[model samples]
Target chain A: MKIHEYQGKQLFRAAGVAVPQGIVAKTPEEAARAFETLGGPIAVVKSQIHAGGRGKGSFKEQPDQRGVVLVRSAEEARQNADRMLGNTLVTIQTGEEGKQVNTLFVEQGLKIVRELYLGIVVDREVGGPVLIMSSEGGMEIEEVAAHSPEKILSEPFDAVAGLYPYQARKLAYALGLDATAVRSAEKFLPQICRFFVNYDCSMVEINPLIITEDGQMLALDAKVTFDDNALFRHKDVVALRDLAEEDPSEVRAADTGLSYVKLNGNIGCLVNGAGLAMSTMDLIKLHGGEPANFLDVGGGANEDQVTEAFRIILADKNVKAVLVNIFGGIMRCDIIVSALLNAYEKVGFNVPLVVRLEGTNVDKAREMLLASGRAIIAASDLTDAAQKVVKALGA
Target chain B: MSILVSKATRVITQGITGNSGLFHSQQCRAYAAECQPGVDVFVGGVTPGKGGTTVDGFPVFNSVIEARKKTGANTSMIFVPPPFCADAILEAADAGMELIVAITEGIPVMDMLRVRRGMEKSSARLIGPNCPGVITPGVAKIGIMPGYIHKPGTIGIISKSGTLTYEAAWQLGRVGLGQSTAVGIGGDPINGTSYIELLKMFQDDPGTEGILVIGEIGGSAEQAAAEYIKSHVTKPVAGFIAGQTAPPGKRMGHAGAIISGGAGTATEKMAALRAAGVVVSDSPGGMGDAMKQAMQR
Candidate 1:
């Protein structure tokens, strides 16, 4: 689950981290008032969306050097906010339709001396929470990692024991901080670790954590992703989830308790388990077809879940064909076939459906589908089923 | 001659009082009874407050300690909920259970981290907290895997992804290379065991002639295991990595399966395994044939 930048800043503030004074405004009128509350001559206006790279994409447009007179006034800010709200702003970070701007952050602009990247993530190799600090910030961290991996310092901490004092100091030293900045950075590390563990965050990143000319550290931008499974524990974080930034098919699948992720392909897949879903997609590609999505109906798939799965797969516009691969162990194939037929009758699937059902009750499942006399095609092997889907899609 | 479990291993179900726990526990008991005559594999159980009760004539104790004390059960299968899964794992570990297989998913990484920290001091080995348990075939089946697919044979299997275990086993069975033991270590970002952990076990087991390891894009667990196999293990190993269809930016299966800036990828893992002299298959269909060839070599 991804939280908006403004919400991430709010979480940082709650954790006692110092951020620029800002207020989230929905309307242009609210934007001017928020500017008034900040009492700053030069305020930074930012679009609040789930994705990053807003500045590079022109989503975040600063006032022209000619100095547009109207934007300085309250009425001008109102008109600007109104025009931008509800409109999709395309960024390199935001794929396709860009991100819809529902809210804007009016913050006090600061003079930056240096931009630094600071983040905490669950490092799989270390098997603990790792704090990533770098002198280079604002740019794609991945580029930095590839070009100069040594620029980034990863300090892992045992979550149970919390961040050690020496570890925090070590990161502060690695950041090459001055005396006061070193103390400040040291103060913030443990707090951020606490925020990470308590909030169940998969990643908490502050890009362009700027050092003001006056030598004060300020978080200019924030990106936080929470663990979706841990959402049950934190309702506040769950409430911050913006469904607009996510794929509609995936959201629908989530609603039906299915794990679905959209990809750029033509063949829609409905598999029983996560591992099988991935393998099915891989096999489809190996057989000269692209998988449209990864949809796992989970282990204990029943009639209702399978029907919902079919509905979700059919809803994808890019899906030229459908592939149902069920390596049934705990789940029965006859039940899945009946559910597929039930969903087919209700939704009236227009695309070709190629199914490869194996394991328990496979013979009965094949007989039931064949007995329906429907246009449903069945294959005995995964490769054959993938081939059929690819040929049908003209791939 | 299974790896982790056999007919002599005593089993206990942790969340045996719950709906899923009770149902699967009963299924396991029935399977054990049908597979072997007079085999008291599932001897005791633990469900916190539901102690002093019996489910299907097997004793249910309050704690793992009591279950171990009363029934002498060495192996435990967990069906606890996600939130309490870490505690259940720790309890079995603290009680000195030799093997603990956790079937619960959605466990928080923090909880698992703490549980793992505690487990570092204990002698008990952990299998999974979000996996489909382990099966030793014809001996004592400790997990939720369909007992029918497995047969006592020479192939030892270790997989990070669960469903691929079933696929590998099914394919291996087709080629007459049934498994001695199959373990699903799960694909969560933070898990108890690694591919190397299970590979070491498979390497030591004498009945296992060859190993089939199914990995996916994620952490360097597969690479580490490949290095281990290259240096130490004499037995032949066949490998297949899933996530060839995953997009460059998208996460494929597990949270750990993100290929950020091109670090851990299926192609990279495959290359590493191949360089390590492991037979790496190109497709899931080729897994059985690859294993067969590796065994012959």
Candidate 2:
């Protein structure tokens, strides 16, 4: 689950992280009020979406403007906010839908002394949460990683032992911080770790954690992603989940308790297991067709789950065809076939469905499906099924 | 013969008195009895509250120690609920059970972390806290896997993935290369047993002649195991890492299956395994042929 930049910053601020004073505005009137309230000579108007790279885009800053006159004179900022508010702003960092700008964050702009990247993630190899610090920060962190990987210093913390005092100071040292800044950063690490564990975050990144001319470290931008599975434990964090930012198909699939991820393709896939579903998608790609979505009905998929799965798949507008691949070990094929037929009846799918069912009463499943004669195509092997789906899609 | 479990290995089912626990335990006992005549592989069980009760003629005990003492059951399979799974595994581990298979899924990551922390100090080995469990062909079935498909043979199987194990085993069975012992270590982000641990065990077993490993995206467990196999294991090994083309930054089946910023990909894992002199399968179906070719080599 992802939250907007302003939300992340708000959470960070609540945790005592230094952030520029800001207000989330939904309209030009609210934006004007935010500009006036900040009372700074300059203010940055940023589109508050769950995306980065907004600064490079049309989002602008009005410098040295004062009061209601500044609000009136800040035409470009108002126009940019107006243009982005209801529309999807496509930034380089944003994937697919870019990000829907429902609100804009108006903040006091600062004169930065230095920009740095700071992030914390669960390191797979280290088996603990690790804080990554880089002197070179902001949008080019990816470039820095690709070009000069050694610049990023990783400090792993044992959650049980907590973040060590020495490790925090070391991370601060790695970031080339001054003594005061080191002390402040040292104080910040425990709070960040606390926030990470308390919020069940998968990642918390602050790009361009800038040092102002006044020598205070201010987080200019924040990106946070919470663990979806852990959402059941954190209702407050779950409430922060922005449904508007997610794909409709995903939202609908979540409601049905099915794991669905939309992809750019024509063949809609529904498989029992996640690995099989992924393999089926790979096979579809290998056979010269794109998989429209990754839909796993999970281990126990009854008739209703199957119906809901179909409903979610059919909801994808890009889906030109459908593929139902079941490698039933514990799951019965005859039961899946019945569910497929029932789902087809309820949803009245217009696209072609190419199903490959195996294991546990497969013959009975084939018989039931063949008897239906509902224009559903059946193939024996995964390759053949993928080929058939691709051929049907004319890919 | 199998490595961990065989006809002579006494079994105890932890959480045996619960509905699913009793039902699956009964199924396992019935299957084991049907597999061979006078096969006393399954001996007794444990359920905290229902200690004195008899579950299908097998005496249940209050604790793992009591169960082990009474029945001399060295192997224990857990069917405890998600909340109690970690405790059950810990209890079994603390009891010094030779092998423990936890079929319970959704165990909290924190609990498992602590469980793993304890497991590191213990002598006992754990298979999963969120897996289908393991099956040693014709000897003992300690999982939810349908016992009919398996036949005793030389193909030693290890997998971070569960469903792919079933698919690979089914294909191998079709090609007349049934498993010696197939273990689904599971795809949980924080699991107990790893590919390296299982691979080492499989390498040592005399009954196992060849090995097949089914891996997925996420951790470098497959790569680590491949490196180990290349260095130490003399037997032929085949590998298949799933999610070769999984989209970037998407969580697949397991929490561990996330590919962030293009790291720990299937391609990377496959490349690593291939570079390590392990025969890597192009698809799930190719696993059997890959093993055959590896054996030939």
Candidate 3:
């Protein structure tokens, strides 16, 4: 999962990486207090959201207001925070809908001589982690790679062996760092790499890594995402999750062991697997309907989980119809049918519902649904199910 | 001839006493009993400490070595949990099993990385730690796929998703096209096999005339396979990628389903496949029709 820039910097500090002093503020008063505590000539109030490109992002409610504002005094910091908090921010990374800003990072401003970029990510093709550095730092790395490919350099290393000294020195010289900064990097880069390995991180990006006039190097901005599958090993990292930054339905689905992503559509889709859930969404779109949400009840879901999934799907007011598609293998079709029936009885389906069951006692499932005499549309197959759902919606 | 398994393939179950292991093992045995003309493919099982006992009439051994020794099994399917899955794969690899299919999900990436490093000197081919295993219709069923939906035909299928494999194979069956062999290579960042490997296998199989490749967002595997098909593969192929409407930078319930650093988009994959002369369908429900049209051409 993703954490805010302030949290990432905190972890960076704990890892022996240099970062500007910062304090997290949840309200305008707190931001003012943080600004006073920093005692700076200039401070930055950055809106804390999961997405990147926050500096270029603008508040939707106050179109002229930027998400990140630099102010000279505590009153200005408070004003900026008041303008940003509880406002929706639209960024290039955050789709058109954007995300809400609930917290701010008030950090002391820094003096920089030059900017560089450093990142550590798993190179899937290389089957290990790689360190990517570039002379072009403040700009988007992908854009830099596209336009000026010669500026980017990468070193792939074995995680088990740790980052080698020679690898770090080579990258430091490749980025054309001066003698003092190069010496600093020899000590700094490996620590950052160690942080990546120590935290079970999937990605660590330090954009616009700055070198001060005094030859000190520091990370100006950090974005870290940990491996979700490895979270069981690190409870401290799991505690960093922010529920306010996520969609409520998605958070609830995770708690209930269902996978759900809400979309802006009218057709509610329920499928047994991830790929099938996505394929079902595509089928819904193919039949001239938009999917309201993508819901995978998992392979071993029971009646209670199914009922909760139905409740979560119906929580969206935009849902016009429901489509239940199950290709049960380890999960029996009769059990799915029973769960569907139980969910309908509990939730009281008002919209048109289409059900398609296949594999493992499917005849019994179909017979049970037929005997129920409910106003549910039983489809013959996947395509038929899509067509039936689309037709029922009068789309 | 099938690509991976046939009537002569011998199988053993690891984690045989577990719920999923016993259920799928029994289902596979029942399918073989009803469909196979004369071959008994499932040989024995392996479970730690539960060895010397019998599960569903199959002898349970303490280790893969003992199971192989007792049954002469050359292939094994794993249903172990995530924590011990890598160890299980290493055990099978060291025991010299020819093909190992791991059906367990959520194996840590670091574990798999170590396993891949360990397999450098070993010759065993691993299919998945989070996949539905291989199946050759009417001959041998190795993993969790329902056998009733498949039939023997000229099509070879390889997929990254378990249920989508069944969906695509069922679509092919509905169109009167039977499958020669179907394999789910699993949905992880690093897997044992790639689409290029399986495509080469299908290209060489005399009984297979067409291929159905089900790809998704997340890696360069599809683009790599497209490049391979452009130069090497001669069989007619159809492609379907899930998550066409998926948003950028979101993991759609699959560990390997994210579009990272502006790559691995469905649109890009589809274009690559089409450039390689593979008929690619936009909607998965229409994939069988797309393959049928490609075959007719």
Best by lDDT: 3
The candidate scoring highest on DockQ is 1
Task: Tell me the DockQ of each model, to 2 decimals.
Answer: 0.69, 0.50, 0.62
- Candidate 1, lDDT over the whole model: 0.82
Model 2, A1-395: lDDT tens digits are: 89988889888889877788988889877776777788766777777777667665432223222111112335555754566666666666675446566788888877888888888887665666788878897746668899888998888877566687788788887778888778777777777777776676788898888877776777888899887656677787777888877778888887888888888887899998777778788788877788888888987789999998988888778889999988877677898898889989999999888999888899999999999989999999777898899998974
Q: Which residue window of length 10 is worst by lDDT in model 3 chain B? A: B31-40
lDDT (tens digit, per residue) of candidate 1 on A282-346: 89999988898998888788778888887887777898899998888866778888888898898
Worst 10 residues of 1 chain A by lDDT: A61-70
Candidate with top TM-score is: 1
- The DockQ score of candidate 2 comes to 0.50
Pitting candidate 1 against candidate 3, the one with the higher TM-score is 1
Angstrom error of the Cα, residue B211, model 3: value is: 1.4
Tally clashing residue pairs in candidate 3: 0
lDDT by residue for model 3 over A140-211, one digit each (tens)? Answer: 998998999888899987777778888888988887778898888888888898888778788999998988
Q: Candidate 1, which segments miss by more than 4 Å at Cα?
A: A59-83, B248-253
For residues B14-123, what per-residue lDDT tens digits would candidate 3 score against the true structure? 99899989988898888887767566788889999988999889899999998988899999999988878889999999998999999888877777878888888999
lDDT per residue for candidate 1 within B38-96, as digits (tens), equals 87888877988889889878788999999999888998999999888888999999999
TM-score of 3: 0.94
